[model samples]
Target chain A: MNNTATYHKAIKAATSKLTDIRKFVAKHAREHGFNEKQISDIQLAVDEACTNIIKHAYQFDQTKNFRIELEFDGDQLSITLTDHGSGFDPNRYQRPDLKKQIEKKKRGGMGIFLIKNLMDDVSYSSNNNTNVLRMSKIRS
Target chain B: MKTFKIEHRNSDGFEIIDLYGELDAHTASQLEESLKNLISDQKSNIIVNFRELDYIASAGLGVFMAYIEDVRTIGGDIKLSNMNDKVYNVFDLLGFPTLYDIFDDEKQAIKKFLSDS
Candidate 1:
């Protein structure tokens, strides 16, 4: 079997498309020999990232497009999501205070936090009109 | 692919919702609507069983957060039970255990609610 493979898909920035995005990542991860647990981790990280883009960046506008690119080389898998919507600096984002969230019972703001913790590497950058978020995980 | 599903049942005077498949941003609304119906009927003593929940994103987590306050205010509670480790980790990561009553089994969750009354 080839140890390296790449796949890409573009979908509208709608919440309904999150499942397809997750399946896309999971399929490539499974083909790369990632175990069930690892595949779920990768799927979840990608799902959360796309959710953030749809809800915060594109505001659930179905007309906007976000592209997901998955590349698997050997035991490592990297996913890059490119969105044409306005971008935010992920570095400037703060992890929500867990105690406060529980106290106030806030319903959101954990998407980026989960993505960072689930993936081995997560980074964000924007060039011109496109925002890119790249996340990677290694099979263990 | 199998989409998310919620099976509703009643056991020992509590509403049990069995969640199956993946629960992400798209399917969270389905859970939300079900919860709304339950709350509307004044059946807020709820236990969500995650024994078959394959995946859960933050949006799914948000659904619980969105309703807990209302449920509790109406003299009822939303309890979670039977989560696989993967699903539990997501809830634990977000400090949900502190905010919600989570149990290892549906019976225990129902017992807690029953004992509270």
Candidate 2:
């Protein structure tokens, strides 16, 4: 039995497009038998990942393009975001100290943290001026 | 595509903001602008009603974090109310309960602000 569905789209690297991307992911997650909570978590993770690309990689330059691919296989869902902007190693990323952030009243740095916690697995790779971030979640 | 909208009202010397639709990185700026306007007007005590909010992301949560200190410095606070399970779950997952006062009802939040002042 093959229970796999894949979706791919190329969008401008702009914040305005984040909502649409999240909607696309949520719609497919729902169709793949994900519950409300699971869908919301996936939606948030995708939004954060795209936001990082827009803000950090493309610097909100709408001229750049970011490609998003979503794959659903059985009870597992995977999201891959690719951009032709600045890329870094995900392993070197450090989780912010929640207590310190709250005490210092920090405003940002929670995007990647939330992505790591919400998704079951997260990996990043960049080659030849292109960056790819992949995240997966398995429904229990 | 759902857009985010915020409705502002003044009640009992507190600014009550009603959030509607999805709140993500793109729409969080609107909330930030509203908070800035409120602070400039010296209306810091705020009660954000989230009953109608369908979705929220880290950027949406960041807006609250950005202004909380400024509001608190002036003897005011931002209290949240009427968050559904989904919205509340995001806040809770990020450990927001320790940083902000979350209430079950808007009236309760308003009352707390009034009593504290």
On lDDT, the leading prediction is 2
Give the residue spans of candidate 1 off by over 4 A: A102-105
| DockQ (0 to 1) for model 2 | 0.66
Computed on C-alphas against the true complex, the DockQ of each candidate is: 0.64, 0.66
| Reference interface contacts recovered per candidate | 0.70, 0.65
Total backbone clashes of model 1? 0
Provide the TM-score for each candidate, comma-separated.
Answer: 0.92, 0.94
**Candidate 1 lDDT tens digits, B52-102:** 998889889888887888798899999999999999999888777876899
The residue pairs in collision within model 1 are none
Give all candidates' CA lDDT scores.
Answer: 0.87, 0.88
| lDDT (Cα, tens digit) per residue for candidate 1, span A25-119 | 77778878899988888888888888889988898899888899998898888899999888887887677776566558676778888888889
Off by over 4 Å in 2: A102-105
Q: After superposition, how far is residue A100 of candidate 2 from its true place, in Å?
A: 3.6
